[model samples]
Target: MATSNGGLRNMTEGSPARHIVLFALPLLAGSFLQQLYNMVDSWVVGQYVGDAALAAVGIGFPVIFMFTSLFMGLANGGTVVIAQFYGAGELDRVRDAVDTIYTAFTFSAVPVTLLAVGLVKPILFLLRVDDAAYDDAWLYLTVVCAGLIGTIGYNLNAGILGGLGNSSTTLRFLAVAALLNIALDLILVLVCGWGVFGVAIATVVSQAFSWLYGLWYINRRYPQIAIRPFCRRFDRSLFGQIMGIGLPAGIQMSLVALGAMVVMSKINTFGKEFTAGYNVGYRLDQLAFLPVQSLSNAVTAFVGQNIGARRLDRARQGIRVTVVSSVVWSLLMAALLIPFGPNLVGLFSDTPAVIDAGAVYLRCIMPFYAIFAVMFSLNNAMRGAGESMFPMLDAIFSLILLRVPAVYFLANRFGSDYMYYGIGIGWMLGFTLSALYYLSGRWKRHGSLADRDRRA
Candidate 1:
C-alpha cells in the first residue's frame, strides 16, 4: 500500500512515461474536484440567487487569485524541495522542509487574512466592479478572505504529499471535500436560501475539512516528523532554500494574476455582458486545460525526483513524454470544445448575448491550448531542476509584458473577439523561451539546494 501510494517509490528506476501517467491520473482527479469547489458554488448561486450575485462572485475572483499566489509559490517550492530530498533518500531533510512550509503558512495566514478582509472593498472599487454588484461582492469576498487559512492549509499539505508522489491521498481528500461542498451548496442555497453567503460558507467549510483530514493523514503516515510547534527551530538556510525557489514562483504567479486583473479591468469597461462572458469562458477554459496543468504537476515531481537521484537523462526523458502527452490531450480537448462550445457556455447563462460572447472567447482560445500545454510542461520541468528564477522571469515576460499589452492593443482594434488572443501569443513566446533554455542543458548543474547543502 505504501509503495502504491508513491511515498516510497524510486521513480528514477521506472519507465518514465508510465510513472508520469500514473502519477498524473490522481492529480487530474484532484484538479477536477478542486474546480468543483467553485463550480458548485457558482451553479447554485446562478440558479437560486441571480445574475447579480453570480457577477459579484465572478468579480471577486481576481482578488482571491492574487492573494493566493504567494502561498502557492511557497507550496510549489516546498514540493520540489521535498521531492528532491525524497529522491535522494534524504528523508530527514524532507521532514524538515515540510515543517518549514507549515511554519511559513501558519505565520502568514492571519496577517494575510486580515489584510484581505480589510482591503476587499477598496480593491473591488479599484477594479471598477459595478455598483449593482458591490454589496454581494463585498459579502462573498470578505467571507472567502476570512477563511484563507483553510485554503492555504490544504494547498500546503497536498503539495507536500504530491512531492512525495502521493497524489492519490490528496485526491481522496479533495473528493471528500467536493462531495461535502455539493451537499452544502444544495442545502444552503436551495433549501435554506442562504444565497451567495451560503456558497462562501460551503466552500470554506469544505476546504477546512480537507485540511483537517490531510493533517491527520500526515501525522499518522509520518509519525517520525513532528507537525506541531511548526517553527520550533527554524533552520535559516533550509528556509532560505524554500523561499529562494518559492518567492520567484510567487512573484511569477502574482504577476500573471495582476496581468489578468488589468485585462479584467479593461473588460469591465464594456459592462456586465462582456464581463460575464469573459469570466464564464475563463472558468471553462480552466476546466478545458486542466489535464495539461495536472500533467505539469506530474512533470515537476518526475523531474525533481530524477534530478535528486542524479538522473538528468531520466528527467529530460520525462519532459519529452509529458510534452507529447499534454499536446495530444489538448488537441482532443480542442476538438470536444469546438463542437459544443456554446452549449457548454449556455450552462452558465441563458441570455443569448452572454452565451454568444462566451462561445466566441472559447472558439478563439481553444485552438491555441496546445501552446499553453508546452509552456507549462517546460516551466514545471525547469522549476523541478531548481532553475526557478529564470522561469519566473520568463512567465512574467510572457503573461505580463507581452500578453497584457497585446490584449489592450487587440481589444481596441478588433474588439472583444481578440481579448483572448494575447494569451495565445503569450503561450507561444513562453514556450519558445522555456524550450530553448531546457535544450541548452544549463539546468543540469542546478539540481537542488538540499543536495548542495548536504555536499557542503
Candidate 2:
C-alpha cells in the first residue's frame, strides 16, 4: 500500500482534528469555487442579461437538482464504502467498489440525460415558471439537463477520491474548472451575448473537463482503484454493498430535492421579484454554508476510514471535533452576513427591490446557520459509519413533514418574509433528530462482517 503522489491521504492515523482540518480546507475551497460558478452566473446575468434572466436560471436549478440527486446520493454512498475499505487496507475491495459505481452511473446517466431533456417543458410548467422568464428557464434547463453525464462523471470520480481520503485531488480538479467557468461565463455571456445559454454551456464544459481530469489522474496515479471496464463476472456482491448504502443516501437527497421543488413552486407563485431575490439569497446561503458542508464531507471520509481500521473511538472523536469547528465557522459567517447582507445582495443585481428582498431573507436566515451545521456534522458522520437510514429519515421528517408545509402556509398566509422562518424551524428539528440518533450510538453496532472480511 504505497501512496501515489500526495493524492492519497490515510486519515486513520495521527490527530483527528489536524487531519480533518487539513482534509476539509481543500474541500472548503473547492466547494466555494464550485458555488462561485453559480454566483458568477447570477452576477453576469443580472448585470448584463437582466433580472428576469437571473430569475429564469434560478428557476431551472431545482429541475436540474432533481435529476442529479440520485447520482449524488449513490456517489456519497460509494465514497463511504470506499473510505472504509481504504481504511481497512483492502485495496482489492476498493477497486471493486470504484468500478461498480462507475458501471452503475454509466448505465444510469444516459436515461437520466434523455429523460431530463425531454421533461424540461413539463417540469418548468409544474414549477409555475412565469411567462416573463419562461423562455430563459426552458433554454437553461434544456442545455444543462442535456449535459447530465458530465455531472455524473465528475462526481463519480470525485466521490471515489474523497472516500480514499484525497480531498486535494478533488480540489485541484475543481479549482481548474472553477477558473475556467468564470472566464467562460464572462466571455460567453457578457461579450458574446450568449445569455442563459452561454452560462449553461460554460458549466457543462467546465464539468466535463473536471471529469476527464479526474478519470485520467485516477488511472495514471492510483491504477489499483482506477475504474476499468465491466467484465462478465462483475462483482455483484460489491455492487450491493455500495448501492445498499448509496440508495438511501440518494433517496434522501431526491426527497430533499423534491421538497425544494415544492418550495420553489410556492416561491414562483409570488412572481419574479421574489424568485430573483430568493435565488440570489440561496446562492449566498450556499457560499456561507460551505465550511460546514466541507467539514461534514471530510468527517464522512474520516469516520469511514477509522471505522474501517477498527478505530470506532477515533471516528467518534473526529465527529465531535468537526461539530465544534463547524459551529464556530457557522457563527462567524452568520455574524459577518447578518448586518451587511444588503451589500452582499447588491452585488448580484442593482435593483433596489431585489436587494431589499434578498437582504431580508439573509438577515432572517443567517442566525440559524449553526443549527443546520450541527445537523449536517452529526448526520454525515452517521453516513460515514454506514448508517444512512436515520439521516434520510430525519431529512424526510424535517423537510417534507415540517418545512414544506410551513413554507407554503407562511408564503400564502403571512408573506415571503415569514417563509424564511421555516428554515430555522426545519434546522432545529433535523438537528434534534440527528443528535438523538448519534447519542443513541446505533451507528456503532451497524458494522458489517463484509467490512471485516475485506480486511481479512
lDDT scores of the candidates, listed in order: 0.82, 0.86
Could you tell me which residue pairs clash in candidate 1? none
Candidate 1 structure, TM-score to reference: 0.96
CA RMSD for every model? 1.7, 1.8
| Model 2 C-alpha lDDT versus the unseen true structure | 0.86
Candidate 1 C-alpha lDDT tens digits along 215-322: 887788767544653556566788888888888998898888888888877877777777777777878888878889888998898899888888888998999999
How do all models score by TM-score? 0.96, 0.96
Per-residue CA lDDT of model 2 for 169-281, tens digit only, reads 88888997899999999999988999999999998999888888878877887767766635323568777777778888888888888888888888888788888988999
Cand. 1 Cα-lDDT: 0.82
Q: What alpha-carbon RMSD in Å does predicted model 2 have with respect to the real structure?
A: 1.8
**Which regions of candidate 1 are displaced past 4 Å?**
1-8, 229-231
